[model samples]
Target: MPRFAANLSMMFNEVPFLDRFASARAAGFEGVEFLFPYEFPADELRKRLNGEGLTQALFNLPPGDWAKGERGMASLPGRQQEFRDSVKKALDYAATLNCRLLHCMAGLVPAEVSLTTATSVYAANLAWAAEQAVPAGVKLVIEPINHRDMPGYFLNTQAQGADIIAAIGSDRIGLQFDVYHVQVTEGDITKRMERYMPVIAHMQIADVPARNEPGTGEIGWSYVFHRMDELNYQGWVGCEYRPAGDTVAGLSWRERFAR
Candidate 1:
């Protein structure tokens, strides 16, 4: 069976961030993930997880100045120091929370920066980050966000992420395969999943067209879940979608497909 994790960042908007832990537990989720935990102390987040008996599935490294539209600094030149500091801070939280996986976002590439330069910087930064993560017992992950959702986002395909993993050494870093992004950027989801399953450390899901719960969109969830089982993907499939209605009500898709 494929395990599901509630993405507290998107789901459960009915309550405060801290309170969503209980909401997730009440909703029958055994694991949880979020975009960022920097707003609260690591210990406080850990306490919530412990109180709810939920596993901390994953979170992202600090994105630079999200308010100013800075998604992440990994591919941006002259931001190596900031990126390194972000890595150190993330590892600290990972240690405190006993979480094993952290997603590294590849920020938007400026028009002035050529793809070759950005790719080179991204690879080099990931290499350094992976070296640091190894001793901490934390495996880093990189996600390929769709350009439609995050325009100019440096990473945009499973093949690209897998190549980076191969070059950086898969032991240190892996891929965060997000279903919605894959469907939007490129179809043939199952084939991509099968091709990259070996390097996929974590997975997330949302329906295409509207990014809602699975059954609300065009995806054949039954087959997707079944294919996951066939592929022997033993990782959390994060419910990272916006609820069209009540969050709890929309989760009925889980029973319908994940069984």
Candidate 2:
């Protein structure tokens, strides 16, 4: 079975991040992921993870101002310096936690920016970030968020993400394939996962139709999990879903995996 990691940012709402680490351990997760760790002291968070015996599987590099209409700009041209600076700080933070993956944000694709130029910038950014990440044994990951959930976001297709990875051609850089986003944007989860598995460094999941717990929505997670098993994918499979109600209240579905 694919190793499971709870997405602490979305699911552990009842407690602070550090406390949530303990909660995740108590809940039987071997690992956990989050959006941003910038808010807390990196050392303290690292201590918490070590104390809880949980691994930091994935987390995003800071993306500016979602509330103020600013999204990530790692792919936008003329911001190479800013992207480099961001990754440097992210590297420092990831080092504290002994993290192996950093999700490089694609941010919003400015209408004024041409797609070709954006792809070029994104490719360059990945190569640069990989240079920083590889030495620390960290894999820099690029994720494609769906347009429906994130309007104006760039890099929405698996083919596009794969092409960018191919262009960059680095073992340290790869796609952070979130099955929920790909299912919403591209549909064929199994075939797409199979097609991109070679370049995909990490994976996350949520049921479709409502972004709820697995088995509570339309996507056949059983088949998806079976496919991953068939492929012998030995990596973290993140439970990155929005809880339909209280997180613990909606956790009965986990019983299916218990057996």
Candidate 3:
């Protein structure tokens, strides 16, 4: 069976951020992931993981000014320096937390920035980031988010992420295949999963339309999970979805769909 990691940022919200680690452990998750770990000290976060005996599955490099709506700076033209700084900070935290996967968000492209320019900047930035991450034992990942959820986002297809990985060398970076985004942007999720499995380093899941637990929406969870196993995908699958009701109450999907 595929390993599932509770996304503490979305799951276990009933308690404090630090407390969610224990909650996730009690709920039977052996691994955990969150959006960002910059707010708290790395030692403190490491302490929580150690205390709960949880593996840090994945987390993102700092996106610039999240409150101001800047999703990420990797593809932004003028933010290259800031993006590099963000990467260094993230690597520091990853070393402390022993995290192997880091998702690099492709930010929304400004109207004035042509796709050509943005693509060039993004490629260069990722190449540089990948070079830095090699020594830290960290591999970077990029997710193609649906435009409906994140309009103007730079990357939006598995083909695009795969192409980027091909150009940058797969050893340094890989794809973060999120079922919710794939279903929203494009159908044929299984074919896409199979086609991209080789380059995929991490996975995330949520049902479409409502972005809730498995079996709560339109996705065929059994087939998806089965397909994952068949493909021999041995990476962490982050539960990056909002709960429909009580988080624990909604976790029955694991027994129902992930069996």
What are the TM-scores, per candidate, against the unseen true structure? 0.99, 0.95, 0.99
Query: Could you give candidate 1's per-residue lDDT for residues 95-135 as a string of tens digits?
Result: 99999999999999999999999999999999999999999
Segments in model 2 whose C-alpha atoms lie over 4 Å from true places: 257-259
lDDT string for model 2 (115-180, tens) is 888878877788888888889888888888998988888879989888877877748778888889
Q: Give the winner by lDDT: 1 or 2.
A: 1
Worst 10 residues of 2 by lDDT: 250-259
Q: Please give the CA lDDT of all the candidate structures.
A: 0.94, 0.85, 0.96
Higher-lDDT candidate among 1 and 3? 3
Off by over 4 Å in 3: none
Best by TM-score: 3
Pairs that collide in candidate 1 are none
lDDT of 2 at 258: 28
